[model samples]
Target chain A: MDSVRALTLIVTMAFLVLAMPAEVALGHGVELSVAPHESIEVNAAYEAGEPMAGAQVAVFAPGEPAEPWLRGSVDEEGRFFFVPDSDRPGTWEVQVRQAGHGGIVRIEVEPAGVVEVTGGGLTPLQKALMAACVLWGSIGTALYFKRRAV
Target chain B: MIGIRTTRMVVLLVTLLAGILTFAGCAAEGAPEPETPAPAAETSDTGLLVFAADGEEHAREGTVSKEGWNITFEHAYVTLADIAAYQTDPPYDVDADGWDLAYDHMVSLPGEFTIDLADPASDPAILGEVADAPAGFYNAFSWHMVRAASGPAEGNSIVFIGTAEKDGETVDFTLRFDQELAYQGGEYIGDVRKGILDAGGEAEAEMTFHFDHFFGRADKDADDPLNTDALGFDPLAALATDGVVDVSLGDLKESLSAEDYARLEDILVHFGHIGENHCIAEPLE
Candidate 1:
């Protein structure tokens, strides 16, 4: 009886191995899928317009400003591209450094896929004040010149 | 005719005033709302945020200068004041905004600190720490390198007492700079990220000084931009008397060549940094 049971078990194990798929047996199979993603491309250059080739790049995601969410180096053209996680929708910072010079650029990404680059330009109030000053100065200068001519 | 001219002038003034008021109103309406103050962190959630000053390995364990003078420092003293850190919503950009930093929360280490960067006891000499700092990423930093009132760096913003040797010649040097400078920098950029304070944890924001910028690196090529821009020890070594070179910024300006003096001034302006990230330094008024 023991001999019969051992022969049966051996036959079952052989059948299972023979029934396994060739790809599963070899274990070299791969799967692929394609999808669209929103990516940001940064071009870093010096004041002289020289490309910062091979410059180190660090990307900081929204709310996690201290750590680099992704790190890479720019290509020969001083360009680096990365697809940020859509789930983290806020201001994304990209820092580029080469040799001893570096700069940081901030991009605002909305949940709805709207992207905008924020700048440090003058505020509207500041612009208004500047314009007011210019106009007042012009007027004052014209009045002064008119009085002098008189 | 005179009455008519007066009336016209009054009308013109009224029109200008009205236009100015209209522009101001429009601008006020379009301006961004000021950020609300960040909510106070829970006592258990708050953490310590340490501020430190680092002169890099060049200050701690000295290396050869661009001119091939092997230099080692005995003391590199820098006096710092008004050191503050911020958690900016849209991280500050030093290049774009200059020193204008906007933040939701800020922690300041109030007081003057004189630190020796070359001291082997602490690689980065700790300036101070805010024990209950809010738990967040302090991304922007600013500080002033002011002349120390009293200490090893008294009467000077920076004082480097070191030795330089090359080609069988050695000089003991003491270089002092009196120019008061203010530096504003963004996030720390290096092999390790910094300024992230977690709940019940500690974090650090570093004020890094690149001494290599002052005495160029011999490891780098002579034609490298850093080496080319640096005012190497050779210039100071040339001014040594009996193997001792001690000078202040004023002394160097009067003794060294005009070109070398200018390079020295330029190096001081670009000395302050956040790790590898550069800061905009302006002479403090």
Candidate 2:
């Protein structure tokens, strides 16, 4: 009877595992969902065609209509996260990629805003001045040497 | 003819003597010597800081402050040595006297609209944060609000801040100072790190040890002096070597007091970078 009960428990455990859907276990193949925490989830795994286990993920936050924030790689399953906790808010982005799988996603966080400041980096005139000075110095040195030789 | 030959021989001997003297002088000149100043204070502004760090490698020309660092860049790099405002011995022994309230850290640059955005009256976006910038900031003259050491933002006011621009970016970076001496429940982002409170009955204040990077790390190198608490680093070696750039002290001093000056000075001395200097080959507005 004890051996029968043990056998019954093992069979029941195997049956329960088989009963659960792949979505619950492996997540319907790495789809995305938005949660109330202002976060996006990407259920991930070792995708087909390649191992897809340990790929590096780098996130470049969306520039427009978004807050610039970055987060990479979820847990062992392959999901990642990005939370807009800063006072500066806008559209935020989270990107996840590993080995040979995954992709990028864009999310918009609202209300708290940012001032987009745009200006010339290094002006052409400044670069020109520096170049001209070096050029003039070279020319002057050549001229000085010519005169001294004479 | 005898007189002529005598003059020629005498002239020859004199010339030989002079030539020997010149050669000896050259040898003396080649010996190692200390730096000599330009008679007119070096009007030749290289716009670089080759000599810094106690004037050992470079002589500082511009006034370096939170607003900007101006150096006579005869060379390619600036050597900035850390300067400390206060020094105290180990453990809380009564023998250990507190740092005197000299207020060594002072900074005042010329800018018009001063705002305590940390104040409820105004709420300016922390522009520096979005820029992936350091924790400190400076208000452009006539643009952002400059914090007042005495007036509205005195002691515990929060406002919009930023420095100038150089190399296509803002010069005023933020120093994530912990102002425990001046605010309730700590008016700083100390939740990420440890800090100390200045004793002043009720009017307390605090400071972040060095410039806080975007990833929330202090710039102090591994050998940073502060421990885990009382304004220290986690690993202590990551003190940032990159200092603020762009604004000059003389320009900043245009609107600062002795106290404000000292406070700014002290803060930079502890947390500023050595290789920091600013240059805008671009047109100045």
Q: Which one is best on lDDT?
A: 1
DockQ scores for all predicted structures: 0.13, 0.01
What DockQ does model 1 achieve?
0.13
Task: Tell me each candidate's TM-score.
Answer: 0.72, 0.16
lDDT string for model 1 (B173-235, tens) is: 999999999998888877778898988999998999988888888887786667877889888
Instruction: Give the best candidate by TM-score.
Output: 1
Q: What is candidate 2's lDDT per residue for B1-285, written digit by digit as tens? A: 999999999999999999999878877889556468757643332111011012111122222222222222221111111111111111111111112223222122222222222222211111111111111211010011112345433432121133323344433432322121110011111111111212211111122212221112122222222111112111111222353422234433443455544544343332322111111111111
- lDDT score, candidate 2, position B95: 10
Name the DockQ score for candidate 2. 0.01
lDDT per residue as tens, model 1, A76-138: 987787777878898877777766566666666665443455432223453454445434534
Residue-level error in angstroms, candidate 1, position A53: 2.6
lDDT score of model 1?
0.77
Fnat of candidate 2, please? 0.00
Each candidate's interface RMSD (Å, one decimal) is: 26.7, 28.2
